[model samples]
Target chain A: MMHSLLVEGFGVQNWTYVLVGITFTLYIGIAIWARAGSTKEFYVAGGGVSPLANGMATAADWMSAASFISMAGIISFDGYDGAVYLMGWTGGYVLLALLLAPYLRKFGKFTVPDFIGDRYYSNTARLVGVICALIVSFTYVAGQMRGVGLVFSRFLEVDINTGVIIGMIIVLFYAVLGGMKGITYTQVAQYCVLIFAFMVPAIFISIQMTGNPIPQLGFGSQLADGSGTYLLDKLDGLSTDLGFNEYTEGSKSTIDIFAITLALMVGTAGLPHVIVRFFTVKRVRDARKSAGIALLLIVILYTTAPAVAVFARTNMIETVSNKPYANVPEWFKKWETTELIKFTDKNNDGLIQYVADESKNELFVDKDIMVLANPEIAKLPDWIIALVAAGALAAALSTAAGLLLVISASVSHDLIKKMINPKISEKGELIAARLSAVVAVCIAGYFGINPPGFVAATVALAFGLAAASFFPAIILGIFYKKMNKEGAIAGMVIGILLMLFYMTKFKFGWFGGGTKADWWFGISPEGFGTVAMIINFVVSIVIMKFTPETPKDVQEIVEKIRIPSGAGAATH
Target chain B: MSEKSNAKAYWKENIRYVLILLAIWFMVSFAAGILFKDELNTIRIGGFKLGFWFAQQGSMYVFVILIFVYVRLMNKLDKKYGYDA
Candidate 1:
């Protein structure tokens, strides 16, 4: 039946429409079925979600379009330097499980700020948490919205802006109606769709190139062509031939790699959306189990990514490097129309030169195109390509909804209920939550359409901001009973301000815009978060020493959170 | 044991497990994957250099294992402290 549909002129775009249509309808249906009836359900899925389901939802929420689409692409380009993301991202779960998640679940809060406010005994700290969450989440969401636009523009042939608007509407519909309840189940379905779509192409290509079905092992095995050459060895040779660094070698300095890895790990632990997922589960033990399950699911993709990077990089260079322009395959031409792949034919030569030298190279390919173009480059089936489209949308939309939830929760629960309108009723707060989600979606859409100059730097900025602002506060709140509100507030303000100052100065060339040579202690802005984090720790400790001790009640709250029993459920 | 001291004991044991687990985490990612990567790269396992594999694949696998191990240890601790409920 499927082959007959294709034979009847149902092309890639048609298949994409069908798959995406089905998935979108499924998401909407799930949303309506699971719509939240109260503030608790909207905020934390009523705090009765099973560990297995929560794990799946967390996995889907964590792996954004960046992970699904851009990670492999970036790894394909950066080679060994890209290890920071792999290790950095997955490593954070260890910290989350061990250091953060269980205790936060025990605290039984609706949001991160709720913990901050109550633990520190101040609305000021909560307000700071809210601001930092908004900054990190909004910066992160812009990239996701762009991912949605990129997929729609390429697959569905819609205008990028139109795609952003469409994505905004769909996200608003589900996020507002179902709240966290709807988002959780929809994300579970999305995780399945995305992982299947990601793996099928990877497995097919792995078998074709290396005769191994497991992509992780295939990347480390000898090629299938009986050349007895290892895949990585062959890629290294190909890279050097084009004047590029050896495929397995690192060009980034050692300290920068360490800093970047640390920053990402800490940032991952601090992300409010991911941390909030644990609050939905029933017990402290379930929180820990669910975190483990989430990481296990996430690693399935994280581990496969490098292998996919190697395969796609090797395949891309072999197909296009030094090849005649006229003989370029159909996929290249298709991508050319999207301007993601461009050929200028320098020196009036018909051959495509993809050399590392910028002046001499005539083929310019966007790194974001590698994963989307991989199946097509390998001559996979049309439905598989369409599957990638739907999968990309699933990844983007799930993460966007998660972040939007955090945004709305911050506004309605933290800012309005806790700060502005403490007398507001439960029903009023629920309405406020939904309305804030609608407004947040619009702002996210605007950024997606007219992305800021720093969109490319967003991952670094978001993670860095989270690392700098949230990690120290939460960790201190949990582990140190004496940590007072003054210390926490001062540490966060200084930490975030330091990160922002460094990022804008280095990334945007603000404040007289120093170059690479002037980077403090040879750390890039991407890695500056690690330094800022340490400073937060030091400042927090020193300030705590000089300031008044935490009140007896708040200290007792800390003692209570440390114990795993009696975690019951997350409550306001 | 008194309730306050019992809680303290549980907390202390939990911290010990975390520190040990976090040490392994640091060793795998920061030490093996980054600081000693070049040294480890001299050794190869099939097509993968030891260090590069650790950076890209091995450390992540270790991290997953570390979490589950921590979970097991914590669950045991909870049971011992009568907090399993």
Candidate 2:
């Protein structure tokens, strides 16, 4: 169906080159504009970040390369059921802003492990917390590296592995030099690049197709396929006619959807990098204010993602039908050579059906490349494609830097401060943090070149690990007065191990092959984190009930954090 | 430990507010999206189905509203307890 957008005499090769050049210069300029100073500045932007600036940075950090690249892919394939990711991600922010942000800020910690250690009054709990944080952070960062590789490979025609390394170097320079301070400012700039890149193509397509200025509302509105049916409703008719669930209807097990959504919410709150952003604020109230603002900015991108997916899919079907294969846009030939997109004229009609198989009813596009392909499928210009390439890079690099910082903080701040050298000077520990950042970048680059799955699919595992281990222990420690160190440690260890088994069992098909019939109440690996979380909560509560109470001193510590009072001023 | 700590009373009240708001949050998201979706679907606003909208856009808008509500409520809670720091 998409083979027809190519007409004789239209070529955008030159325009693509110019757009890519401008985006690169803009990012470097913005990075220099928001340079870092001092260890304090490097770590938390000197705790002087206005909620507005911080919001933009946090939005960039939170959205990541996956949201920009893979979310539309997911929506394009899964149709209306894909709204779960959209709702889960945006909804998770509500939990972050209200339930977790203020209390963690009041604890006044440099990292997530620091808060867990202090709250539980046990180094054992801290160690477990650090391990979980590392696993989640690394797994997610690896996906970002792969995205960076894809963007670089597509535009520059560099080796994919080389592109990954290039991304690592750029990220390492700023993240190592400036820490949170540098990353924050760069992320704000990155957000601007990404959002503009996303909206420009979307707006162009919407205007061409639906005469609508807003790409978001255009999703549910009628299509311009000249078919005179609502876009989703047409997709519904197309897919359902071929035996697919209607585009707006859901077909997945409701239990699985509920569980996966739960896991994602907890995971978002538990992520160390995102939570640490709150600690950058001066006052506890400011932390709450910052999260509110951060969430507002995040929604701007998150809400628009699903809409873009629907618009792109509807346009793709009409664009590709009944035309010669060579007549498809030059972008298809271009992307196909990269192996990012493929075409098969399913019905042997010399035209892509794109509709569905009567048996499966699934659209054939690779969800990972949906955002990049959407512009071309809609037959927009080449500059938008180049902008998408740059935006994908920005998304990948910003989150990679954020995750790498969290890993370094765990090593130098928690592990080194407590175990390696308890008496290490602050100056020395700070150096260790910088060195740790470099090491993490190298490792993430390695994983990026050799990725485990499509970018978003890979990061979803990180969310699972976070939900299973960190979320439960932290929430219990903060809210449940009876939860003690032993209970927390036991819960985290059990939660993480169980989640690992769940993930490996399916991904590797260990113990015979394929998905098991009995998956601890039939929860898919995608939703295992939610189940593990509930288990952790239950285990901690049951054990704490039988064990002795939290020590009086620990109780007092909890009381202190609960109050919104002084961390006082630091003269530095 | 100090005479003017004010923290103890401040914490007690804050906990109450969080509990109440969080309960509403869960009901809107989990309950409305999955648990009571069938019932809600029967009630549509305009061309959009209520249950689907809740799952797609409604709950998110509500979640945003809830946070701002939390912000105002927390501010009032802070000022009332004389712990606005």
Best candidate according to lDDT: 1
Flag regions of model 1 displaced more than 4 Å: A1-9, A453-456
Which docking class does model 1 fall in? Answer: high
Instruction: Summarize candidate 2's per-residue lDDT along A2-64 as a digit string, tens digits.
Output: 455455332344455566567656666666766665556666777777777787888888887
Query: Which pairs clash inside model 1?
Result: none
For residues A72-105, could you state the per-residue lDDT of candidate 1 as single tens digits? 9989999999999899899999999999999999
Task: Give candidate 2's fnat, 2 decimals.
Answer: 0.44
Span of ten consecutive residues with least summed lDDT in model 2 chain A: A355-364
Alpha carbon lDDT of residue A237, candidate 2?
68
